[model samples]
Target: MSKSVRLLNGSSLCSGRLEVKSDQTWSSVCEADFDQQDAEVVCRELGCGPPSVLQGALYGEGEAPMWTKEFQCGGHESALLDCRSSDSDRNTCSSGRAAGLTCSDPVRLVGGASRCAGRLEMKLGEWTPVDGYRWTLETAAVICEHLNCGSAVSVGKRKEASRRSVWSIESDCIQSGSLLRECATPDHGDSILNLACSVPNCRWRC
Candidate 1:
């Protein structure tokens, strides 16, 4: 079995069901009581990248008590515990209703004119290009969505003239619900992924 890290219940240190501490006890957070700003603070506290996915019940509900106060973060707090709170308006929180969040793993698109278009790279211990093996629109969409660049518009393989070291992205693991960063492993490949995402203010090129 996996061990708990920090204040959240999750598989990785940065992705998991939202939980908070109050009065020397930890409790799960209700989805209604959490928001994007709250999520940002949690990610920052955990030393992860920006918030990627925020969904209720992405991780199983915990047996711990539910937090009774609503968080009020302004999106710039250094830590979740430092934010202000108010009496929770929620009367009850049922099972599978706890807030679950996935913080991004410092993934980015580069070498292109726009933030949404370029070769894919991820930062584990360091920034490394991603091997495009078995990469599809579905898998590429994960990166685009994490970057808040909307959906994936296109995915194509780019073969560099010279083979280089890269991180191999496991499509099966990702399709099975693992985050892209969690599924990446160090490997070498001849080709990398080129992606174009659809941003709200950009055309198909982005």
Candidate 2:
């Protein structure tokens, strides 16, 4: 059997048993209010699928510490034994805490260009310019996707009259498709100039 599962408050669950395979070692985990939700969290953290089973009392109660409680989870627990504060203390079963996640995938472009630059004229994807006319590294990366690029390496902002101007001077090694000289902006915001491979492309409204 493995060591007891210690809670954040230093309490331990020693009732039933949990079969866990870690480092090639098959050990038993103490069952408490632990449920499918907690199991799901464990699986996701370990890059596994969702948990479909929640055994209680270790099938017959193992040796040493015995579980004090059994919890019923919604199968969306964030961590092992992550239940409500009330249930966290009680030896009863209830729904567990759900895990929240945020992720981003890298985008791949077609052609290979070490650097590409364009003026900031519109917002797309997760990039939003500041003050309706400014661009930043974070915003530039979002714009790169529109050009089918990997990411933005550099960003330059220029202000002219009432229009706030921005420019991405470097493509950061994103592939370009057919040297897009002209691109129509999603809205009638501002006109932008795109330069690829040291050549200037047609200007379009973004």
Candidate 3:
């Protein structure tokens, strides 16, 4: 019998079984590609840590094939198994894509006791920090704007200093209407924060 389980519709292969340790406890596969250049793609898909150690047959081979050959992919590996296969290639196996993924910790948003001096820290997620900039008041305002929090009450620097920088802001306005502009500024150095916007209820950190 096939030890693998069939994923439901809208279920992702990354949501399927991943072999951690040496036993078969059904772990979620981290996104990491077999090839060096494509490893980051795996990290982006599983929503986990960064691809530090990429192992092909680390735990062991899977029970079945999750994907086809000709695995040309962008950095996004979430859609790896869903990609169309090469018709001309017949020697390939219909097994799962050979990958290993580890996402960096997520970015955490620490609410301030006073609401004006909140902070953001890197947590466990699929995001990374870029150099050359720090979060600012206008960035906080942008986050509030996306959340429909009216206007940003404050924005301040975080105490912890690392490759990743953090900042905090406050707002009461909630997103009710369509956004006039996606970001406060398009310039690279504008320092405007980008956040996901949801109608009715704003997901500030998203």
* Per-residue lDDT of model 1, residues 1-206, tens digit only: 11222435665667888777667777889888889999998887776778878999988888888887788999998878778988646669777889999877678899876899899988776788999778889888877866779999999888888889899988878777665666878998899989998887654334
Question: Candidate 1 lDDT (Cα, whole model)?
Answer: 0.80
Stretches > 4 Å off in candidate 2: 1-16, 19-32, 57-60, 67-77, 81-206
Q: Write the per-residue lDDT of candidate 2 for residues 1-206, one digit (tens) a residue.
A: 12223212111121123534334544334444444466655544333333333454424433323234344556565544454423344433322221121111212221234324543333223332223234445545555644445566665433435543322323322222211111212332233333222223334211
Q: CA lDDT of each candidate?
A: 0.80, 0.35, 0.35
lDDT of 3: 0.35
Candidate ranking under lDDT, highest first, comes to 1, 2, 3
- Worst-scoring 10-residue span by lDDT in model 1: 1-10
Better of 1 and 2 by TM-score: 1
The most accurate candidate by lDDT is 1
Instruction: List the lowest-lDDT window of 10 residues for candidate 2.
Output: 7-16
Reference-based TM-score, model 2: 0.24
Q: Model 3: per-residue lDDT, tens digit, 153-201?
A: 5544322232333221222221322121211122222132332222233
Residue 87 CA error for candidate 1 (Å)? 21
* Candidate 1 Cα deviation (angstroms), residue 196: 0.5
